[model samples]
Target: MKQFTYVITDEAGIHARPAGLLVKEAAKFASSTTIAKGAKKGDLKRIFGVMALGVKKGEEITVTCEGADEDAAAAALEAFFKANL
Candidate 1:
């Protein structure tokens, strides 16, 4: 498993459009991806699960990827968050 923590930089946080894009990005990986805020964790490939977290700007999120493509998945997700969230 690979993991990275990031603080949301976007003023809108992980809103609808970015959340949707995030889910799509997670789905592209063979590894399983999960996003966690404090004790709450959600499937990164599920839009509803992601949105349910209510991630506000400046809040910290930990993304974890586990499986065959964990490294790539983690890298991609980190890049996505930096670019869009």
Candidate 2:
């Protein structure tokens, strides 16, 4: 398993557009990806699950990827958060 923590910088938070993109990105990997805000976690591949967390700007979240492509998935997710979230 691989994990990274990130603070959201987008003013809109994990709203529809970016959340949709995030789900799509997570689906690209073979690993199981999860995003957690405090004790609440959601599958990164599921749009509704992610949105349910209500992640907001400046809030910290941890992303975990486990499985065959964990390394790459973690790196990509980190970059994705930096670039888009």
Query: 41-84 in candidate 2: lDDT tens per residue?
Result: 99999999999999999999999999999999999999999999
For residues 41-85, write the lDDT of model 1, one tens digit per residue: 999999999999999999999999999999999999999998888
Which number leads on lDDT? 2
The CA lDDT at 49 in model 1 is 92
> Once superposed on the true structure, which residue ranges of model 1 sit more than 4 Å away at CA?
none
Off by over 4 Å in 2: none
Instruction: Score candidate 2 by TM-score against the native.
Output: 0.98
